[model samples]
Target chain A: MSRSFSTSERRVLGALHYLGFGLFLAACTAGFVRTWVLFGNPPSIDPLASHRQYIQLLDRKQDYESAVDRIEIAQQLAPYTAAVDGLSIQGYGQIGLGLLERGHPSTARLYLQRLFLALEQTTELPSDDAEMLDMLARILDRSYELGTGAEAILKDSLLLSLLNNLAWIRATHRSDSIRNAEQALRFASRAADMTKREDPSLLDTLAAAYAEAGRWQEARQTERLAVAQAERAGVADVAISSMKQRLSLYEDRLPYRE
Target chain B: MSQADASHFSVTRLTGRSFIHPLFDYLVIGGGISLIATIVIWQSGRSDIVPMAVVPLILLLSNSAHFAASTVRLYTKRGSFEALPFLTMAFPCVCLLLIALCLAWPLRLGMNLQSLYLTWSPYHYAAQAYGLAVMYAYRSGCLLTTSDKRLLFWCAMIPFLRMFFCIQDTVLGADIGLAWIAPSSLYRLFEPYQAGLDRMLLIAACAAPLVLLIKTWRSSSGAIPMISLLMLVTNTVWFFALEPINAFVWATVFHGLQYLAIVVIFHVRDRLSEPTNRHGKLYHALWFYGWCVLLAYALFFCLPQAYQMLGFGVDESVWVVIAAINVHHFIVDGYIWRLKKGDSNRQVVDSSAPAAAPRVSSPAGL
Candidate 1:
């Protein structure tokens, strides 16, 4: 049996049939574009998520070049998703930190400044939106030697903790840096008191601050507690390594090694 | 079973479709609002403008539109009985807009210290009021329902003034001689009954686990799933900001996970409620456990980097953790509970009306 359409039905059917044909052609074109876009890409890769994870992992390993590549890839993905803004900022900060660790101060400064700018752009989001604050603190902490300007701006508890750790770094290096370093240490110690006891990293910063300020006995006690707390948080290896580095610097400074 | 009883059971199963539709609708609406708000905020170019301003405006506009469309749909389907729920939802929508307008007027007119502080006060009230109104809408009750007037109004209206207290503490810490905002001030404002402002939010966030537990114990097959989703939303609000209770986010996550587990049980039993098959229960339990464990691990590991990107301080790790945990709970619990059972119970228990037809569309799948 043959079915005949009413006037309205014929009109609707004609519109839908044409639309479907157009969509089929568009889909074919889209498939071609997608094929070209992923010509040599790995089948299992999510470029954004994978790049972000890789940068974080590489930064942990202090591999600056690979981390930078991943960071660029993450940044490329940012235009597609708002959530990637935070990932890009973190990647840049990590790369900058890695570059700084390798003694490339100028390159590190550029990366850190870029990270800072990215964070600054996003800070007005919400009170609870902490992405900017975290990136800014990390940058300020890692590149504290960049200048006094950063020290004045990053007065928040997290950055202050970073500055306090930087003070310990400065205290052992140059005689001219100790006064500002002492001030930073004091600020960090106050910050530590407001935080929970489980945060071993903050305790380390507090201890480092005290040590740089010539409060030797208090520093030793704090360092011991910090080591224990760090172990509990599953970041014991990093803490232990930083502590060992601190011990060597202390031995160089004071004739008596606790 | 009698033919009538069997027909009722089939109807119960059919209720799932209604529940699923509203949930998908809510998601689409909320997502649309968030996207539009993001664009507006990005374009506003206010040095002091906050993202907090965006979502509410989006909600206010989107809800009003959705309500209008729904009013027409309801009127077409079931006449007259729809008006009560319609007016209740409509009145609140108007009030929210009016409140936002009044609050924005001062800032628009001129900027002053008083205006800045005053502007923030409206947001706090808005959050509480919106919450109350939405609860009523969900419950299919009038504004003067027992939950609002008897329970929520008095409890939320106390205005613990935690923000002021925190500001005072910051000033005092900067200068030891500053006496206006001290720990003693907190004692005077909230001592024995309340946990102080900071801890009060923490207390609220912590309540999610208990609420879930009690709801499950009393009626796991009841409103257990919906309440759990609401808890997740509330936790996200509390933990994301620089609120007093933000520090306790990890603990909040634990409670959320437990709630997620119970919600799973409710859904699985709802799907296959035959009086036999003990092993089915074990399978359901294992599936829930596996999901919770996977989510917990992923959130714990990836959250720090998320915080870093959001321009948050490392201390803000708690917020990311809370957000991830709640979203995970929403997805997992929503899949199990909302998909299994339909609106047969919600439509009856909530208000005997279909005003809550829209709730099924919420992104969080409440």
Candidate 2:
């Protein structure tokens, strides 16, 4: 077919093809240029620049719905195409967490169901796909026990993650007041490791778990480390504020110990 | 011989050539008459299923008889001076009978003129499966003749389509009712979750047949076969991972697209030559049947006229029946024209210059 075209015709068609190819390349180049000029390497990959401020406002007013909505929208568009699926799972998880915070357990269950489904479809086998699958499995396992029907959502990976989270929580969080605080720490720590040691929430959860277990020295150390890591990674504000609050609480109890 | 005598001899040869070429003419004319006669007898006998019951019996017996005759002829013609001629004659008859059997039995199985072969009979469904098998056998024979990778690819996907459709129909719970693709007992398996999956699969499946056309595109060599290979790979992936509903839709669309691709191939060849005074009678006839089936589907749906003209109520599910018929017609016609084109291409290549040659290459035409 290529041979059938005359030399002149070949030249014309080839030119047309190359011209279209050039235009496509130019569009892609222009898109990257605009993105760089506008953002110039943000402190964090927070798609919604105002999300932290909104969360702070929500925390002060205790407006869970507004906080949830901001986080949901931000999470949805956070990742580039390479990381979009992971971000989607994270977005669903955040939605569920917001629902739980608002005391809407039934609604939270529904959001968890979508998360479970998305996680089920995704594979975390390191060779084939991104390692998002393991993190999702851990989240779902916790959700399964917390939600109404345990057996209905008891997926194989979820069960595996449940055992791992429980073991970690038992070893670290031995305190009685926050019995499940150790479990939350274990879940978040394992999730962070599974996500290539990237997520800041894992650090936050571990610090909380240690504090609940009355391991004050370990809790303070973990919180300080978490704040430093978040700042270095450009996710500074939230973890830094939380760390300052924890330090003040520790200071208040220090005089009695001395 | 003298010049006058030589001219007369040449005239006779030319006439003989025309007569032999008119075999298709006789086939078409004879088939039409036989169909009319069958309908007349069918109407006169007119008991439900009984009138149509004889069609299968007659076809089976006649085919069996033809097979026996061909076998006997093959035996009698063995190792004799005149054996070659008899053997040649018997061979074609046997082949023709096999083709006739393939077309007739499936066409007859649970066929109704008003409904256009959409009765929910197991026999008809099985017959479609049988037809797909015949297509596989036909394609295997085809692989020997032309180097078209795309045709070979379409050949490969045919079985996957059969399997997927079989599962789909079962899941969908096909009954005599005119349910096209509603949430029935069959679809309940995945009803709780998403939509649009089936349509995406359908598009992929439909595009699957392009492997053949794209492969056979008039060109040099090896690269074209890749198209067929890619189609086969993608189709295999779709068949395995996708659920039966999506899988079946994909298979159906692939089947439809295969036919449409062949039509495109014909148009491409027709335009390439742009032969003066082109005889499109056969092409037109084929198109007529294709369009007629579509027209029948449309007419069946237009209720007031349908009730007045045919007095049979229409259901939306009748569209499924129409679709099934369309699938059958597409595959059947695709096979016939492909065979014809292959034969003609071979003849043109051998007797004329390469420029005037058809693209197909079958031994019969050669």
Candidate 3:
């Protein structure tokens, strides 16, 4: 079935392939350097998609390891992407709580520390799901409404996260509709107690909740303690400065709102 | 469908069994260029020698070109517009609607669509490799027994299997590696199992093809064609040897070359088989490729720019459109290349002319 070909036809065909290859290669090269190099190729937008999708899904699935892996990648790919960093903040908080529940406090602290630094940097919660904060608020409100006790409604880690995250949101969110000082105090006190106040970040959240409730005396005292705890624990200088700034605000009888 | 129309095509081709020339097919379409370039890059140990723009350039030339080639061929093949009504008439609308949905719901639909494309990419590459290998074998008058066919199929699949393992374990371990949609728990729990399995998969990726070759050699007493073997090895090396980031760039380009080569061959063949085609192979090849380039530019560049004009971010406009284009190509290829009786693709398999004597041997139930 092999068809015979003239020698010249074979040469022509082979030459044609070379020509095609050369032309395409030349076109791409010229197009790339002249146009794309001047303008830039489409920025790889992997993290833009990864921000909302991977971290939230993995965290919800309680796949902490994979969530951490994705968080690391997203962070590496787009360092300042608020959505990704915010998702990482939430992811790390959940992962730390999960690890602690599994009796890995040392590992838990590692993730919690990352969450702490990330939270201190961001002025607002940029977690991919904008409704997530509302969801946390809803969960907390429902738990309180259940009358059976918030502790009974959520697992230990979930309860702690709901308390910490919602308290932070209520105490510092710019929207007055979401802020409720008394509720913030209630959530923060429970979180402080749950962490035994040893965690400086939780203490700071409790202090912010205190400032929101207009209890300037307790706010100053709590913030002073938070600042001390933060410094004693060798927290980052930027965070210590932030805590100190909040301390000053309470000293001036001002409530912090981000 | 009629005698006069059927008579236009000469028996398979008027040349030796290899599509175009054996040298042309083997070197350009057979993964030879990719293999050589990869070896050179690795041996040089200086990946940076190539500018970063080369990535996009390669994508434009090879990746984008080959993808457009399928669509161009589908539309240009005489009677295809009549044969594939949905594909020609309505399927583009389907693709357009899908793109709009993805654009409107970037998170819900767009991410899923993007992930689908990412996950399907490697599988598509492997499938094309397997396809081209088999087509080359058919064209070259190589007879593959049933067992031989099965062996070749699995051997070709080693690349996918290797990728599957590297991702963590299962397919959907189909990693969170090349695949965008893998569960974390499977990827993590299997972490301990991964190292051992990777070694096994690596061994298998390398060894399985050799076994297939030896077995086929013993059974059929015919050596597997060099092009087929090259395809098997190139796919394996593409996933394993090249750095993952670089692999994405080079593999697509090389695979693009392979696709463009065969698609050009088929396209020219189809054109020439038309009794009315007054042009020679070179003219037809250039015309087809030129259209592919134009379409590629329009699809990849201008469409994205148009989306940007409509207030989409450059990211979604470019990537989502790219993803949609790929899914369209993949789906179209799945249909256009089916080799059934009375199918245009039957000519691709049949070595003789349309009514030229019976095929010396069809690939089992090809």
Error (Å) of candidate 3 at residue A177 is 35
lDDT of 1 at B189: 60
> Which structure is stronger by TM-score: 2 or 3?
3
lDDT of 2: 0.37
TM-score of each: 0.27, 0.25, 0.56
Superpose all Cα atoms of candidate 2 onto the true structure and report the RMSD in Å to 1 decimal. Answer: 24.9
What is candidate 2's lDDT per residue for B1-366, written digit by digit as tens? 687445333422222221113342122211222233334434565323334335323322222122122222222222221323322222223322332332233223212221222222222222322233223222222221254433553444443433433333433323222222334565565444323444544455555546543543323321222222333433444344444444333333332233233333333344334456354545643443344333332222221121212222112112222333333332233222323333432232233221232344221111
Model 1: per-residue Cα lDDT at residue A181? 46
Q: Is the docking of candidate 2 incorrect, acceptable, medium or high quality?
A: incorrect
How well is each residue in A1-258 modelled by candidate 1, as lDDT tens digits? 013445675555546545544543453344334323533322111213333344445555656577654433233212121122333565666666665666546545556666656655663322222443344445565455655334434436535444444433433334342324455464466457657545676677666666667777776777778777777667858658787566445444441112
- lDDT per residue, candidate 1, B1-366, as tens digits? 687445323433222222224443223311222223334434573312435345323322222122222222222222122223323223223322332332333223112222232223323332333342233234332212333222332233222233333333321112111123345665556435433555765555446435543443243122222332333334334332322222122212222232333234333554345456455766865554454343233333333333333343221232223222333232222222221124322322243333333332221223
lDDT of 2 by residue, A1-258 (tens): 102445575555556545534543453344334334533531121212223433544545655465565443333222110111222555555556555555545545555676667655754322212233333444455455565422244564554444334433432333432245445555556555655544444565566556655667866676677777777888758657866676555445330010
Q: Residue-wise lDDT of candidate 3 within B1-366, one digit each (tens)?
A: 466333222333222256667678667777777788888888887666567545556667788888898889887876664556556555665676687778777656766776676566777777877776666555544556777777778777776666655653221211234334456665566667766876887788789778866775555324456677777789888877876556655787888888887778777877777788899999999999999987787666655554544554444545577779988888888766766576555775574532233232222111
TM-score of chain A of each: 0.34, 0.32, 0.46
**lDDT leader:** 3
Distance (Å) between predicted and true CA of B221, model 2?
10
**By TM-score: ranked, best first:** 3, 1, 2
Per DockQ, what order, best first?
1, 3, 2
